[model samples]
Target: MDIHTLDLNFLTDEAIASFVVESSDGPVLVETGPHSTLKNLERGLSDLGYGLEDIKHVLLTHIHFDHAGAAWALAQKGAKVYVHPFGYKHLLAPSKLYNSAKRIYGDQMERLWGLMEGIAEENLISVEDGTEIIVGDATFIGWHTPGHASHHIAWQLGDLVFAGDVAGCKIKQGPVVPPCPPPDINIEDWHASIDRILGLKPSRILLTHFGEVSEVETHFNELKEILQDWAAWMKVPFEQGRDPRDVTPEFQAYANGQLKAKGLSEKEVARYDAANPAWMSVAGLMRYWKKKLGA
Candidate 1:
């Protein structure tokens, strides 16, 4: 299976990615990025001598805008969208999902995510955990790996796992950081998900945040470490009951400082921010800590 990564060219380069995997049946799309970069996705497919209509199967790692926002568009083009069973209703209707995102993104909603429409029920294939989906010679398994989002799934294609946010976000040589977005940030579940990914013994992992991640074991170890570190860091502010608006900037600076400590330049650091905004993490982790504390 030949895998190709398409740079969505999201806010900055190397921020978001969509992957095209070759199978005996045809081209299978892993992540669709956000519809805001749909043209870029089309161009990437065209460059590879295929078109959007040629994609018969689209496997989404999750329903996040960055990972699966453009899925409805592809489904409109007649692609069978493979997603977690928990995410089926939202993708089919999408009104509630779109409105929720509208609340988070507000005025920048269209600019960041574009218009997200609903996919036909027929085009939406909700897969059960550990379900094997055979598409020609390629057998893709959907692993329900939550923690990032309750509806998340890590699509396993042989030894390569298309890990969405569960694998966290890493750009270039930057440090791997967990993207704790609202409504679904489970530290315990995330740790378990990490263990599950490692259980697969993937030779390599593909991150939707950017591209391929080698050094699977080491990367995951680092990810687990950072996940704990960030959660601990958030615990302080959460206990203090500090307003998130006050903590977001501080956390952002702290995160950027970590990136700079790694010798990443301003642009690289900014790319990390673009990929995983600090404010969202602040809110997400705060909510997680609050719930854990039974607050």
Candidate 2:
């Protein structure tokens, strides 16, 4: 299977990407990105000699709007969207999902993610953990990898894994920072998912936040380290009963500092922020601690 990375150009270049896999039947899309970048997705496909109509199979690693927001558009065009069972209902009835995000993004919803519409039940296909879905001659096995989100899946295709946000966001050469959005952020589960991914021994991992990472072992190593580091760091503030708003900026500075230490430019740091916001992680990890500690 030939895979092409389409840059959604969200907020900044290389911040978000959608993968197109060439198959015997047609081009299978891995992620449609948000509807805000649908035009970019179209142009990228067009350059690859494909079109919106040419896409018949869309494999979503998760149902996060940034990853699968434009999926409804493809489903409307007769494409089947494959997603985790937990995220199935949301796609079939996206109002809840849209409203939840609207609460967070407010007036910037349209600019950040465009519009979201419900997918017909017929077009929504929920794949259980370890379920294999074949598109043309290419085969994709969905692994239920939660931690970042309860509905997350890591799509294993051949020797590479479309790790979505489960593997964290690593842009260019920046350090891997896990995206711990609210509603679902369990550090223990995320660590287990990382171990499970390691067992697969994939040669390459495609991150939705950016592009292809060839050094699989090293990439995951950093991801694990930072994942724990971030979680532990958040514990300090949370245990003190510090307001999340107060902790967010501190965590942001800590994350930004790490990026700078790695020699990333100011622009590079901003791109990382675009792909995964620091404030979200603060909220996510804090929520995780609250649930576990029963605070």
List the global CA lDDT of all models: 0.92, 0.91
Model 1, residue 227: C-alpha shift (Å): 0.7
What would the per-residue lDDT of candidate 1 be over residues 119-215, giving only the tens digit for each residue? Answer: 9989999999999988899999999999999988998888889988899998887789999999889999999999999999999999887688989
At residue 25, candidate 2 shows an lDDT of 83
- What residue pairs are clashing in model 1? none
Over 4 Å off, model 1: none
Worst 10 residues of 2 by lDDT: 268-277
